[model samples]
Target: DLHNRFKRGARSYTGTCKDEETQMVYKKGQSWLRPALRSNRVEFCRCDNGYPRCHSTPVQSLTNDCFTGNGTLYRGIQSRTESGNSCLKWNSPRLILKTYTAWKKNAHDLGLGSHNFCRNPDNDRKPWCYVLKDNLETWEYCDVPKCSTCGLRQYKESQFRIKGGFFADITSHPWQAAITTLDRRSPGKTHFLCGGILIDSCWVLSAAHCFQERYKVHEIRVVLGSTYREKKEEDEQVFEVEKYIIHEKFVSETFDNDIALLHLKPKADSLQCAQETKSVRTVCLPDAGLQLADWTECELSGYGKHEENSPFYSERLKEGHVRLYPSSRCTSRHLFNKTVTENMLCAGDTRSGGKEGNLHDACQGDSGGPLVCMKDNRMHLIGIISWGIGCGEKDVPGVYTKVINYLKWIEDKRRL
Candidate 1:
C-alpha cells in the first residue's frame, strides 16, 4: 500500500494526525448537531445550523433505574421475571448467544459492549456474542478512521534545487526537524541542539548521543516547517517534548546503534501534537528489506555549520546531495579509528574534489538529522547523521546510524 501511495504522486497526503478531533468545528453547508440527552436516550441534538444549538431540553429521569425502554436496550436490571428478556445488573444476559456469529450491528452501535467487541477472535472471549442474540442483523463501525499513516511526503514547491552549503527551503525537505534545548532558569529562549526526523505524527527519530546531557523532556523542543533558524513563519509549528527513549545498546565510545525516539505531547483537547500542512510533514520509514545500490543518489539537510572550523551554525536550513559509499570504503579504517559496524552506513560527495571542489556533507548541528533517499519517489529514511571526520573533507565520508538495521527495534519501542 505504501508503494502504491508513492506512485500516485502523493496527492492523498494531508499532514494531519489520524486521530479524531474533539472540538465541534462547523463544516460549511452542514447542520450543527450538538450532543444531548433526551427521551431516556443519549443521542445528537439537532441544531438548525443557521442558529446556535438549543439546550433547554432536560434529561429524562429513570424510574427505579430499571425501566426497559422501547427498542432493544439490553441494560442490566435489579430484578426480573422468567420471560427470558430481563436480568439483574450482576447476572448474565437473559438470552446468552454462544458465538461471534451471533453479534448484531445495532446492539454494538448502542454500545452494548463498548462498541469495540467486534475485534475479538471467534472464541469465548468475544464480548458481543451474547448481546447479539437480540438482533442478528447488521454490522457497522461508527466513525473509525478508514486509514492511518497520513502527513507523509510533503515538500515546498520549487522550480530548481542542491548538494552542499546553500540556503534551503524546509518545504523542500519537510521531514527535517530542528531539535532544540532550553534552560529552566531562563525563560522565553532556546538553543538549537540537534537535528531530527518526523517518522510518526507524535514521534521524532534522532541520535541517542544528542541527548547526552540528559536534558529533561520539558527542556527540549522540536521545531518543524521553518526555513529560517530563528524566524517563526506562519506555517511553522512548535512542540514541547513529552519524553524520549534512547536505545539501550548505544555505545558512547563507538556510537553503535545510535538512535532514539521523541514522543510529542498532545494538545489541550488531547488531539495530535502537530497538524499536517505543506510546510510540515513526515518521512516514510524504510522497510527492513529495502536495499539500495551503494552509489545511490540521496540527500541530507540541516542548519549545521558549513565547515568543521566554522564558529557559528547556519542561520537558515541547508541541504546537500550525497551518494552511498561501498562497504569497503565505509569501513572503520577509513573513518579515523571509529568502529563502523553493520548498524552504520557511510555517504559522501564523491563527485567533487580539489582546493575548491564544492563539497557537500553533513556536519556539526546536523547530528541526529535524516539521510533520506528517493525510494519509489517517496522520501524513505536511510540513516542518521552520527559523526564524521570533518565537514565536507576530501575522501572522507560522514558516518550515519544505519536506520534499516533498527527497523525491529523501532517497531518494538513504538508499540510500548
Candidate 2:
C-alpha cells in the first residue's frame, strides 16, 4: 500500500478506546486526542474510515491530556505532525476554495498581468493607461505624440526627405550644366533654348522670354560644360552668346518682366578643366530677404517642346516640376483691377493639366529659364522665366519673375 507506509516501523500506543487487545488503538476523541497527540513524531489520527489517524506518540504520552495546560496548544499540534505527509498531500480545502475564486475575479476586472487584464469594456482594447488628449485625428487613438500618418507639408517649411527620382534628379545642380536639343527647328534649324545655369566663368542665368523674337546674342550658341545638345562636340568647352541683359522691364504681351543675363565672352578653357567636369558648375543667387513661398519647390531646366509640335528631339536635359502659385492665383480679376503688379510667381496644375508629354510647363523654347531652389545643399537662384498659358493649360499658371522681388534689381545689376 504505498510501500506499506514506507516500511512502517514505529507503532506504539496505549489507549482511551479501540484496544484490539493492547494493539491499543483508540478513537472517540481520546480527550480530543490530547490535541493531536504531542509526539515522539508521527500523528494525524481520525480513521474509523473517515481516514487520518497515523500514530506513534508517547514521548511521555506527550505531556498528556489536552496537552496538560496547553503550551501554545502543545506546539501547534506538535508542529502539525512533524511536517510529514508534506502538508497532507497539498493541504486541500478544495484547493483553497479554487484559489480564492481566482483572486476575487481578477481584483474586480482591472484584469491582471500581461495586459489583457479583463477584456470587455467595449473591447478594441489598446488603452492600458497614460493618455491625456487634445487634437488626435490621423488613425485616431492619439493621446498626443502625433504623426500617426498624414504628412508632406513643406512649402519651404523645408524638411525634405523625399528621394524618388526623374524630375532630373529632383532638379539638378550637383554642379549643374545642360544642353539638350533633339533638333526640331522652327526658323533657322537648331532651336532648343531655355536652360542656362553656370553662374560664373562668364555668367548665364537665363529667361528674358528666352531672348524674345528668337535669337540674338551672336545668334545663340553657348553650350558650355554639356548636357547633350547632340553632345555639343563632345564638350571640352563650347561658348558663344557673349552678351545679353534684357530686364529693362521686359514686357512682351504681358509676360511681365522676365529676367535674363547671359554674358560669357571668354574664360572657358573649360575654366581650367572646370574641376574635372561632370555635373558642371555654378548656381548660387538667392539671398537678399529670400521670400519665394506659395507652394515653393521649384527647379525647371529645359530645351523645350518635348512633345507639342514634336519633331522629335529632346534627347535628355528635361526636368520641369514647379509649384509656387498663389499671388491671388496669378492676378486676373481684370488683372487685379488694372494695376497688374503682383510682380508674378504662379506655377501650374490647373487640375492635373500640363500637356506636351508632361514635362509640365515652360514650353516653346522655355523662355529665360532658371528657377532652381535646393537650399542648404546649395543651388539657389529662384525664379525668372515668366509667362505661360499653354504647356500646362487650365487657368494656365506658370509665370515667374519674383526672384525675391528682384533682389535690389539683382544686386544693382550684378555689381555684387
Per lDDT, the best of the predicted structures is 1
Q: How well does each candidate superpose onto the true structure, as a TM-score?
A: 0.65, 0.23
**Lowest summed lDDT window (length 10), candidate 2:** 144-153
Q: RMSD, model 1, all Cα superposed?
A: 16.3
Clashing pairs for predicted structure model 1, backbone only: 15-276, 156-171, 163-320, 163-321
Query: How large an RMSD does model 2 have?
Result: 33.8
TM-score, prediction 1:
0.65
* Deviation of model 1 at 406, angstroms: 0.8
Off by over 4 Å in 1: 1-163, 353-357
Report how far off residue 141 is in candidate 1 (Å).
Answer: 6.5
Per residue, candidate 2 scores C-alpha lDDT tens digits across 1-416 of: 43343233113333233322112233345321222223345333443422224455554454432221112222112212211211111122333332222234442232211111111112322211211134321111212111111111112211222111122421243234432232444554455556666656466666676667655556665565444545444534655666677789877767666677666666443332232233445566777777666776776665555544666545545555667677766676623333345566667644353333443666655556566766666557677665565565545566667676776775566673
